[model samples]
Target: MDIRRYAPLRAAGASWKDIAAQAGCDWRTAKKYLSPDAPAVPPRATSRAGTVSRLVDPFTDVIDAWLADDPGLLATVIHERLVADYGFTGHYQRIKVYCAEARRRIELESDAQGRPPGLHRRFEVVAGAQAQVDWGDEGCLLVGAGAGKKVYSFHMTLSYSRDPFICFTTSQDLATFFDCHRRAFAHFGGVPATIVYDRTKTVVRRHVAPGRAVPLHPQAAAFAEHYGFAIDVLAAHRPTGKGRVERQVQIGRDHVLSGRRFSSLAELDAAFAAWVPIRRGQVHRTHGEVIAVRAVRDHAALGPLPQFGYAVTETHLRRVGRDALISFAGSSYSVAARAADGRVTKAGQRVEVRVGVEHLEIWRLPVDSPDRTPMLLARHPLAAVRGQMIVDPQHWAELPDGHTRSTTLDITDHAPVAAQQVPGDPTPSSVSGSMVFGESQAALEVMVARRPLAYYDRLAGLAAPPEPATTAETTTSESLVGAA
Candidate 1:
């Protein structure tokens, strides 16, 4: 303690013993405190924490210039630019250190007026290698004669070129989901190897434990099989896993939908179409390359498109009605009859009906085992008009002769016929017989009533039914008729 007051005397050339005698401390202890080389002469913990530095000094000035131009420059960007522009060979840690110091200085000078700068790695992928897809709600589309309609906006961006394709749909059902993919692939001229998606209902069936495989919607699996692409589903609650498409959704809201009035869903789609070329034509802020130029490289790497796309089918779970009938889209299609006696159908049995643009397929899962392939009960051409009942003939053929002989109904036919009877035993004229007592009329009525089935048999033998024509034969006959 005495060294504190007498330490100043040592600077004036006082000897250690002379200073110790004045301060009442031992000469050895005083000499220790007074020694110029003594470690105890300095106060505890006063040294700076970040005093060490690697002399990669030139990049600091470049970083400073970048910061001066843009006060929000990120350390990572500065490091990237340093390497690319000035051929800086210093370790990135050095630039990071400089950036931290620079940021602190900038923050202190601004007194909390500016937002702190941070950087994220901009991911890049080969053009056709991968794409990120997501569906977003774009509020209401003011269209038609009424109020605004809710729209489900679909966004997809090629991971490599940042080239984007968008479609605004009315619903996010699996068919619409597949349709969006088809349109995106067509727009890109080829399908990517992988399509990344968040855990959407259309893509993922349910969540399970971590590292377990996610079950995909059956239609999604079929669509992927048809298009030859792998489905990449991110873990639940991880939006950043598919960050590319998520960012595009934000960009779309800002640039395409923000402050804009669209009359219809189609108009919204057209807006996206028009914006795409402009988006791809500009130089990307992160890549520092023209999007159009990058897209050229992207297309070159994409897989060639298939010759034919899948005929998308909308799937619905339906219950089989009695008489093996299932109704869909305001029409009824027949599955096979359950019994010849018209007792019942496989009623209450769950059937999966896939209604396509052209056809309807009824699939029934086996009662014994749920995992087995579903039995395809029937497929009928989808009716173009409502209230039409479509029946496959082979289904009816399994019934008894009496039931099988019933007439086939074609809703598409417009012909009309009066009720057929060989003769009537009584007529309205006979109800109250004003003109009834005529012998000649009685004879005529008797003769008509006596007409027999033999008469129709003779006529049927004379006139044979013509075979039904097929699609190819019809086309050939039409072409022949045209030639003639």
Candidate 2:
């Protein structure tokens, strides 16, 4: 309160009560301030310094040990450990406050590796000299009918221009990984000199001992060779080696997908496509130039793409099942029983399967052929959902089934026998080499002709029975037929 304002009022014959009422202060304070020589004294401000709760003091050493072991340990986790193991009777906020200071101390002391946290070389690559790549796990998305599928994003950011390219996929297999690389290169209009990647299995065949030569994935090597770029595989636990793309991964999630819901991979990709231009127009923090403008210089310095596009397909050897099906990508695809060259693909025969992002090709292995060339067996569009069976009806044509019985009869062996007749009956005439046994039907049927009892007696190798006398009409017809 300023006492000078009430001083004039006090000198004008105002009582202490009246001055206190006017000044909104107590009457005793008004009497002191209203005095002629009373000096204005601002209220002394007081503050209580914040300190770690005394309740947590007992557990400070344990907390420090945990923090030193892992500087990134969360406060809630520490609080839980303290409550469960240390019998700490403190609120979570106290533990949180303590952890903040503890973490700062740990960070200042240096990381667990005994290196200062801030001691690192900041790098800036020349235009088109290098690009970084990484994958972001976007969790599950309801694609169709609320069926959830794991979604992932492929990110590539030019180290110089900060130009970013992102695409969404349902898979992170070797084929899909390079397929996204091809797309990113195309979007940037050329390939960089070196592409930096963390030791993803797609990029690195296996983890090798430190200082040993890293073995690059065969397909990755081929892809990089085809695109005229070098594969720079970062060491384990070295995310900062490709920090440009690592940061872009988060930027993509925050700017494009933070508040959006997508029904399909296409929609998610479209969201990225729409945001990329907006990102390019903004001034980059490090480069201090519009990303699109800097991207032009980067694109101009990049190496030209190869004349032919590299086929990004993951090749695997699969044995054809007895059912002429080959299992792949959690689904089964049918291969033709009879190959194009008229060779039958029997069970247990290994075939080469080249799986692409959207389709898969089955090739018959040339195991014992004069020309060692694989024959294309079948091509099928990939299944939309897992556990699906993709079948071609024609592929099962040569395979036997229960419904393949024939309806025709062959009687050429029995054609030479002459027709026999009984007494007083016209003899049946034989035709051609085959006989019409019965009416056309699914099952073959034969009609048996009746013969005299004497013929059966002769065929039994017994004494021939005496022949009975024939009627005159039968005798005349028989004689006329014999004469003709």
Candidate 3:
């Protein structure tokens, strides 16, 4: 009955009589069905095939128009359109098959032109000799405790070493930007021979007549100069020149920064520092050694550090407020009182406050002063007052109860009496006070238990008692009475 079953019987040269007996059919019936040369039985007509043709032929024109315009249109959409427009009632599978064939035809036509060309490969640079520097803004997030924290990711990569250093910060100002470089240098323990950079506004002044290298942004130039290294800028719009660092930025985002939580910038920075060592220890798939080890071998070829810190010109001028304040890194710092209402010009590491033409050096600035207490204020005061505390055992009882206030008074008492006098100048005064054996509590208990009976009588009268005299004051009073 089927072609596959009859083909083997005919191929074996079995007569129709034997085939009929094996197949359980009459000889005449088997002969009529199995004979390949028997006039083909006039090609029996299939009702189902006719039904399929009828359903597809009616929608062929509409399907062709849709395929020409949008070959990506789904089969279900085409079927619905056909049913609404042309009264199509075929199953969805047939339309899907037809659409697939149409898509194949479209693809064949599109690829007939062929691809343009393969990417051109360039000469490779020596390993660890150079590095590329650039910044990428990876959006902002609230990253600190409580609320309203600002954070940004800073990315850097070595051109030849392919080592990457990523950091998170609340600022992109010169201080933080330079600080990141310092950290990176310290991490690798040496500076790169030549650092390639892009024309960021923070680093590039101008295009220098269309295509020439723009002068380095003063601060960035100073950083390079301090380290005794050279900086080269890539041609504008040619990001591929710095492709190594760019690729590293993506890798860092995927592996280190993604799905990590940090409560503060300090916390994030600590986590990043921890991650750097792990990243550095990993052997590059292309190169054999770890990136950190490679950088160390390459660092020996670098130049020595410069003697003087590099000088940088001011890029912007901002006015100091009446409160002696200037803003940087989304935080405020107060200059000296003399520098208030003056013009403050910032150049990389230095901030010069000008009153007319004269420059006032600002010794200290308050960094952490929100609604909360400022930590820098306390630290600065402590540093300024170090090594000036009085340590006399006799006057310990007369000192104040509060530790900070007591320490402050001790420094004041031991300070030079005359403005021009240097430290350790002796004062001609006798010291006589109870030596408090322990802390303030012990001294207070002794004073309460050992007070004279006359002292309580004076207190009961509610009268001002005679003032106690120091040894010098008593001697002066007696001498004055004798003179009188």
Candidate 4:
């Protein structure tokens, strides 16, 4: 406290209490200052230094080693290790109590020397300057999809507006991650200057030494390069570094996903899309600005999307199935029979399958050199329906000669099946084929059509099995169908 005001009061005969109140000091201190006998001594501030507690203190070194080995290790685990290895027969409770206190202190002391403990200061970036991306697991939400199948939601939050672009996928593989990036850019209508991310596996390949640049995954690098954005990987264990997106993940889980039941990943994505406008209309919890209002700045600040959008692809070398088909992303896509004959003779015929977000492309080994790019075999729209066998019409070109492009045949005879069913015919059938090994066979015939069960059901007004047609009913039905 400054003693000048109280000094004048002391000289003016005011009481020390009143003087100290005016000076904002203790009465005793005012008396001392009034005593000119006390040398002008500055107040002594308390020191944080203290004697270390020994309850867990004796085992601090052991705990330190354990923590150094694994900072995430629990106190209980450390205590057990201490007793088993160090032969310190201390009570488990004592060790546990010490551990609860020690781990935090030890970790902070170890990795963060000279780093002061304090609340994280929230930061704001200029609009279009930054976006934060993260992934969260929304566990086991689909029925008949698979057991223990988890859906992960990828979120990219515009740092300025809190505008979020979200995607849900079954995997965080390279292709899906890159695809999400592309979709996020499209959703924002522009690309941010930079994207901040936690050191997720999809982006970061491994943890390098501290203070050194982290090596990004190749696909992640390609994606960023394609989009003209910089990647800013957050420091290890520092979610607060990109707290905007981190908080959004929690908010999204609670607001959008909590207590909701979805039958598929697509349903989950649709739900997020429907929920986003509500979030945009609401005030951002952290910045206290309406998300939609802030988004205008964000949109203005972003760089225009590149001329050609990113084509994110994940390539896999898969053995062609015996049926000249390659299975990918829950669907089977066919290869040409001639291509399969040339390339897929054995059970393990390897073909490169490059899977995109909404397209599937097939590639075969380079004709001459392994170093050369694989030959592009076929491209097809990704199937939205599960278990669909997607076939490019051209992929079945190597059928026996004289067969039309659309002809489908079941070869049950040793000789060729010459009969081709009329495309729209129904039930003129009395045909069958049989194959005998090393024996001559008769000319074969095949019949294919939509079953007449539904027509007959309507005609009879009951779910009756298809019976042999009666002459009168068949004629009347055909005439009525043709006239209608």
Model 1: residues >4 Å from true position, as ranges? Answer: 1-123, 144-148, 236-238, 312-314, 320-350, 355-484
The local lDDT score (0 to 100) that residue 202 gets in candidate 4 is: 78
Q: What lDDT would each prediction earn against the true structure?
A: 0.73, 0.82, 0.59, 0.75
Quote the lDDT for 99 in model 1: 81
Model 2 per-residue lDDT at 340? 74
Question: By TM-score, highest first, what's the ranking?
Answer: 2, 4, 1, 3
lDDT of 2: 0.82
Candidate 2 off by > 4 Å: 1-118, 142-147, 405-484
Task: Please give the distance, in angstroms, between residue 447's alpha carbon in candidate 4 and its true position after superposition.
Answer: 35
- In the range 234-332, model 1's lDDT, one tens digit per residue, is 865567777878899899988899887777777888888888888888998878899889989887887877888886677888887766688887899
The alpha-carbon deviation from the true structure for residue 149 of candidate 2, after best TM-score superposition, in angstroms, is 1.8
Between candidates 2 and 4, the one scoring higher on lDDT is: 2
* lDDT (Cα, tens digit) per residue for candidate 4, span 1-484: 4575456777778998998788787889878867768666655546654655455667888777777788778777777788788777777788777666766676568564556444566777888999999899888877765546778999999988889888888878777888888788888899999999888887898988778999998878887898889999987778789878888899889988888787787888898889988988999777798999999989988998888876777778777776678888688888765553254333456777888777888777775225565666678888866799998777666545454555333445234333333323343333454533334434454332334556656566676545666898678656644433
Q: Lowest summed-lDDT stretch of 10 residues in model 2?
A: 441-450
Candidate 3 local lDDT, 115-200, one digit each (tens): 33223345456755787777756555445351454566777676666778777776566556766776677656567788887877
TM-score, each model? 0.50, 0.63, 0.44, 0.62
RMSD of each: 25.1, 14.4, 19.8, 16.5
